[model samples]
Target: MEEYFSAVRKMEQTVMFPSLLQGVSLGDLANTLDSSSNEKDLYESYTLLKSIKTMVEDGLVPLNQTFPVATQMKEQEIKEEEDLESLFYYHVSSLYRILTRLTRRAKAVTSKYDEIMGQMNQNEKRLSF
Candidate 1:
């Protein structure tokens, strides 16, 4: 169980944080777009957006699925009469909360990506002429 939590924390730090950072950067780039913005900047933003999309699809989504399973397994392992059960429950609950927040963050980032892509499409059309 300890190992499970450790693995989840590692995923959160290594996978989620970098993805979130990329999302933020992408959002910033999107917000800075204007008539003067060039294709190079748009390309870089699109590349970063693709990378983030892949990470969320291939990495974070799987990690998110594991959290609920981990919580369930931890709950199963708990003994009603055990003194340390509360601590275990606390950890499980914490995992659930983290999972919830992570999912929400991912959804927000996905929406931002969609919005940016729409803006980029418009920019591309403007540039084509």
Candidate 2:
């Protein structure tokens, strides 16, 4: 369980840092657009900048709610050895709920990131205009 918590914490930190870095990148991109000399380049940069913002926001959600993965194994063992159906029902079920919530959140973030990437690609296609 300790290892599980450690892994979850590490993942949380990993997720947080990338989101922060992405925000920094988006800011830098915005600054670049602000000083850009060409109008078309500025518009494309602005579009890319918006997409980056969306990605950063989407990445933050999972970082906010991390769950320890080993909790279920522990509960399962306890349930088998002690014949404690209620404890298993509560702890294991809670872990499942948390896992499902996190999974759904990650999927949503991924979808948002994909959408932003698609928008970025579309903007890239139009950059020559």
* Cα TM-score per model: 0.38, 0.39
**lDDT for each residue of candidate 2 in 77-111, tens digit (9 for 90 to 100):** 66576767776697788866644443333333333
What TM-score does prediction 2 earn? 0.39
Clashing pairs in 1: none
* After superposition, candidate 1 runs with Cα above 4 Å error: 1-82
- On residues 48-80, what C-alpha lDDT tens digit does candidate 1 reach at each position? 434544564465555446666777776665654
Residue-level lDDT for 89 in candidate 1: 88
For candidate 2, list the clashing residue pairs, or say none: none
**What lDDT would candidate 2 get against the real structure?**
0.44
Root-mean-square deviation (CA) per prediction: 13.4, 16.0
Candidate 2, residue 2: how far the Cα is off, in Å: 21
